[model samples]
Target: MSPYSPVAEPPPRVAARLRRPRRPRRGSALVRRAASPVALLVLWQLASATGVLSPDKLAPPAQILRAMVEEWHKGTLQAATGVSLQRVVIGFALGAVVAVVLAVVAGLSRIGDDTVDPPMQMLRTVPHLGLLPLLVLWLGIDEAPKIALIALGVTFPLYVNTVAGIRGVDRKLVETAGVLGLSWWGRLRHVVAPGALPSFLVGLRLSLGVAWLSLIVAEQINATSGIGYLVTDAASFGRTDVVVGGLIVYSLLGLATDAAVRLIERKALAWRLA
Candidate 1:
């Protein structure tokens, strides 16, 4: 090729350099993520200071923060948080176990699917909260009903995702496992479980969110303790600051849990990244 020929192209390294997109600096990215929330808080503070926002209607962020500190000093904050956390943990564990077992049973066999799935589908259609009255009647106004409600809320999302994951596993992979002379348990351990893991983790994230929401609703049902009870008591006394603080705690808890699950997903699915 002549030196002046149009056919002559840039070197591979040069071409790759031209094609690659520039990524923002890590510090800049962090600042960008923090910017919006900080701006919103500032705007809120300004609105409250100018009397554009009514304290009775909604407590200012400053007041909410102060109220939270007061609650902490009184020890109500710690107690409520611990109680709420316990309920969520127990409820989530129960829901996860039931959902996974059902998903496995239905996913692994046609007979199991026919026997188990239809009724579950029907139950999924009914609003979980609608069952609260019946649950209260049967389980009484106690921890049992509250925990049951949370578990009920957590079950469907996990079940649907897990079942889909299992069913979606590649036929070729299963065949390959069989050809390799892997026993049923071996195939399940190596192939099916790992293949289904991503979906199961996704379901877990969703279920955790649902679990928190359900706890909020459940605690509203004659709750004697927990964040819900604290908020309810604050509302009854017209302590808007305390009520707002309680809500902030709930939101922060949800965000924290979701972040934890995301971290787990990254670690669990590192093979995909590779």
Candidate 2:
């Protein structure tokens, strides 16, 4: 080779520049998400304030805000919220437990699937809303009926999703666990429960929405307190602002609960990020 024969320069070093991550814009996400709702509120306020829309039909954002503040000051809103929260918590717990038990039985055993599935599928089809009259008649117009109503609404989605998730666990993994002599509970803990988590979370979110809806309906029937009572009371008294304000509270509660589920997902599913 000639002395000046082309010397191969070393391939350029693949330097990955460790640039600093962008600083999170504090409240940026909230502000961006608020855009559309804010615009709609602006339009609503303008129309109601300027008489472009009849206040008799609907209240403006300002009026709704004032009424909400008034209720808050009077402690009615707080009391109602507490009552409603209690009902939801109790109902959700009851429903979630029943759903998990039923799902486990149905998903894990052929006998259980045969016995539990048909009735559940049939029950899910009947609109639980229509059972309001029967519930009131049987259980009386009290907290028991309301709680039971909410429980019924919250159950089906969770049950369906959990069963699907459990059934979807990899048969191979399950067999391997069995071959390794894992006990029933051990196999479930290792191979089944983790696989079912995501679907269960999705069901949780869905069931929460249903729970609120059922509460709204249940409270409409002789409700003495709760956000639903607030709406019904306002409608009777012709206070459109208060009615709208109560609806806003419902929306906020739903949003907050969904956010909570999302937070749980982030923590529980951190393994996926790996």
> By lDDT, who's the top model here?
1
TM-score of each: 0.88, 0.86
The best candidate in terms of TM-score: 1
lDDT of 2 by residue, 1-274 (tens): 1111122211112121344555787678878889999999899999988899887799888888899999999999999989998998999899989999999999999999999989999998888878889999999998989999989988888898899989998899999999999999999999899988877877887788888878878988899989889889999988999998897787777777867876887788777644
Clashing pairs in 2: none
Q: Report how far residue 210 has shifted in candidate 2, in Å.
A: 0.6
TM-score of 2: 0.86
Task: List pairs with backbone clashes in candidate 1.
Answer: none
Residues 55-154 of candidate 1 have per-residue lDDT tens digits of 8888889999999999999999999999999999999899999999999999999998998899889898888877888889999998998899889988
The per-residue C-alpha lDDT of model 1 at residue 229 equals 98
By summed lDDT, the worst window of 10 consecutive residues in model 2 runs over: 2-11
